[model samples]
Target: MAQQLAQGGLTGAAKLKAVTDLINSLTQDLSTSSLGPRERDAALDELKVYARDPRNADPIFVKEGIETLSKHAFDGSSATTSRNALRCLANCLLVKPSTRNIFVDLGYPEKASIKLTTAGVEDEFLISRIIFLTTYGTSVNLQNLIDQHHLADAILQNLTRHVKLWTGSSGSSFKAASQDPMTDMALTETAKLLFNVTHFCRQKVDSFTPAIALIVTLICQHALPQPKPLDPPLGSLVNALLTLNLASEQGAAALFPKANPAALCERLIQVLDKAVRSYPDRELDTAVLPLITALRKIYELAPAEGVQRVMQAKLLPTTKDRKKVLGKGQSLASLILRHTTNAMAPEFSKAVSHMLFELSDKDATKFVQNVGYGFASGFLFQNNVPVPESVQESFQASEGGRQRAVNAITGQFIDKETAPELPEMTDEEKEREAERLFVLFERLKSTGVMNVENPVARAAREGHLGRDVIDGKDRVEELD
Candidate 1:
């Protein structure tokens, strides 16, 4: 016969009773100080596992079980115990939103804010997440977090450490490959909390201006690696940027620093390039739009040289690019222009179109000049923008500037491509050509080639040569 329900060790009602009994025993043990540290931690561990399971989750939270978890979550001496306890709490909060009210009533945000002021990487990640959760559906006073706990300053300090670590101002592991995984997680979590606080306290964001520079430096560095559409640090980092004003003077300085503005601008281009190439519209709405919006803001605040890099990297068409259509080429400029017209991603399309207009110096003529009338026209006309009358005249680049016009629909010049067959020459014109061939053969004859024939001499003997010899312009005209 097949094995049936409630037939083996700890099955059905018996197992349920045994688990409840275990929770009862562990709860009573952790509630008291009579148990040794090892015994207490052991009891907390078993109870933590039971709390993770939905069936047994409620039994552990009813009495001293939650208090025990909270007490140990702050245990400074035992790193092992603290991490387990934090994980246990994280699970509880995630599984039951009601647990937030319980944790809030326990007045943990006050303690969390205090610990966050000095928490290390692991503690930072765990505590930041927990407090961030409290931001939702709880009686937690965020204003008190700002005024009393120095929350903004603490986030700024930790973010500054991440920046220093990235920029090599501090820490031995300066590069991403060398960064501690724990530190990376901590930075992401802290940034998420930073977004929450700023989102909740928009009027008080000026307190976070100093943090704007730190985030810029880290983002500029992180973007170089072309991370995933929603990778931790970079993704959270961009969200953090979206909340703060890039127009802040401090943020502007970092984004367009005199030392090397392209360090910021170009790296962001790489990030954007990767985003458009990697994901479709559905994912782009989340993974891509914020980045585009953030980059557009940065560009709006970018300095001349910074704007110059963006133009060169994504707008200006090169001489070699003229032979082919503008957006048809595989260049970055082509890729970006193609997306400017993408219908599926309307917001993305509109954002990019406006950014392109801004980059075009917000003048119709410059827009046509840089991105071409082909790609510029749809956006311009739709917005009731007029194409400058002089756009046609502007298309003629100065001599030695580059190659001239491609198809206007292709954005610029319509090259006069060579014909497949040569045209028939007039008699005089044929004579001029025969004379030039004679000159070439005479030079070859001088070089001691025995078989060389002076076509001019031969043609003259045959009465087929021009009446005059090849010479300068005046004589050549007479010969023709």
Candidate 2:
């Protein structure tokens, strides 16, 4: 039968029909009481061979194959057979997008999702393939997965479980083992599937915040480090970052709030910096653009405190010497400016400029001083690609625009206007307060309350030490 299916001179329709008949027969055999597990396994193997053919993507055949495979998939009789069935379905879905609906219609989504929970490496791979394929269709298709099969939740659960398993009790173990090529590849595909789901179903992604956080944490934990000679892989890390960027763009900023923005900014800068250092001459525009975009999104969506934290982090080169060499001692601002000036791709430069513009909006004088006015004017110059008008205006308006330019040209750290000083306690006042505290401590000590040992006594001491200990006791008595 296999020979006949592989034989030449058969029409596509004829081949599909033959494969369909083979699948039907296999399903019948598996259903029979007389067949042993070995026989059933053999039939499933045969089904896998034919079902994987691109010609077998006809909707009717796909539906029939899915129904048969889904039965065995959920039966738990044999992992190998179930996995083969999943592989066949995945292959068909991959070849034909139309089969995705058929897959959902035949209740395969729910079954596939259930399998995802307990799937081993190979089975998980196949199941992920199916989910990834489904993601290629329209948003409506994604909605079906979310609404009917709860695919979003399932994938999140699967990712969380696998990541936990991979990371073990201490996440460092997973990072250490991430260098295994096969494990890395599997995880990469998983991350890709996650990216697709999140990208297609933005409105629904919020509910999966825990899963999103886990993925971000995993990426930040494992990928932020400089790539080892034998790191797990970069694909998952890249995809995870892309997913985060997409989610943030779609108004999901909650996940990033707790992530140390300063550390995150430093990590992103490190990725771009390392890439540029490695390939000094080549155009890494495509490779580094996503990182830059992700950085931009972080700045746009992060809370004020988070954004301030990132701004305070040392992200750019501080010294002119380092800028000349394109060497170490670089700050985030310097990196952005240098890349803006020298980027081979206009889009890359634009991304960096937009980030700079945003930072300028946050503090125009600081941006002007940090990158220097000459570099700032050139970056904000409206030649071919223009900076936001507001950015240009902000620079012009900063320090009435004149002093900032002069200060930038002269390399002066002087600010024309100083921030208002906060009120401070003088030494005399400090000494007086200290003396009062000492007297209060002595009084409390004499009363056998040198420390805050009891809640009532602590409350009384804290409340009354400023007054008299007797008054504190009276207040405590009134409360009692």
Candidate 3:
């Protein structure tokens, strides 16, 4: 009877209530007897049915079901029993949009919805779920659940301990006797969860610090016995730090007061130097660009201050690290010379030369012509670092890069003079000027030139830049 109803063919509230009542009666009747395996299975089946029915679930009943399932959790017959109860409880908490709204109204933000929905974040439900997945096959994958919950650290703690046991002291014991399938399964699931959590945390800077700290802790714990699987987590941590945003300089100032205007840049410089000196090539390659992009954002916000700090920190490193960074006997000096020719901040412009100084002469010309051109167009010229070099030289190397720099400058580019003198010109001169400006406009578009205020990028990404950009731009632009 419980099986038929638990199957979901009979899910109406009335049917669920009847099954709950029947289970309640059975528990009372069978409380004292030790049922045989078959009979125990029958009792387990009834509870599983009641636990799975959404209408039969409430905070009260679900908590009772979890207790009942825990009694036989290690028993093979009880595995499905515990898993069903968890699923049913999760379903009830997530019952409907209106139900979730009730929790939200009570002060739970959307970020905590998983907890609010279950009313179980503080309860044993989350920990128990982790346990069941770690111990037995309950159909749900443990790692997937961790990523979904944003509980990477919790998951790592479980995986590292389990893996150490399976591969270390327990390895000889298990090998001599026989491998325990259940134990091995638990270890595998924990590993997957660890990997998943690392991947999810990589995409955001705000999430990086906690993720790295957790991964490092886990790796250190399992370092001696297991070394092969450490790469992904370690690489991810490096990438996360390298990607911290400089644009948040103002916010960072609030956190680290001893830091000067360039405090954030200096900290990152220290981090990069440490990484290059101690970390592997794979780590550097994957992390450097993202870190630079983050710094560029900070520089965009406060160019002079940001540039001074980045240069003073001497982040580009000595020519040896630069050679390693630029790759293969490449010329670093000439590249630096060519790239910084038109840079806006003389300090950043000069600092980049250090990167070039590290490259070999054979590759220096191409590097300067290409990569150098690119850095200037995108960071210096396009980002409004300023154009100190001859206009023709800057534009020739990266026509697109130059146009982008021009666009950044022109975004705040008010013609300083009140207005152009209203002197008449020949129709031919006017036509020539329009054509020249038209080419520049096309160049900006083709090269993906953007300004300090990236309306195009914002519009493409968020539909609009949000209230801050729209409202702030209106207010800021009015002063000019």
Q: Which candidate, 1 or 3, has the higher lDDT?
A: 1
Model 3 residue 437 CA deviation in Å: 17
Best by TM-score: 1
How many collisions between residues are there in candidate 1? 6
Residue-wise lDDT of candidate 3 within 306-344, one digit each (tens)? 554454335322233222222222233223333354333
TM-score of 2: 0.62
What TM-score fits each model?
Answer: 0.75, 0.62, 0.31
In angstroms, how far off is 229's CA in candidate 1?
Answer: 6.3
lDDT of 2 by residue, 213-291 (tens): 5665555555433542113334355555565433443335434544454555555556666655554434546556666
- Write the candidate numbers in order of decreasing TM-score: 1, 2, 3
For candidate 2, list the clashing residue pairs, or say none: 178-232, 315-331, 315-332, 316-330, 316-331, 316-332, 317-330, 317-331
What lDDT is obtained when candidate 2 is compared to the true structure?
Answer: 0.57
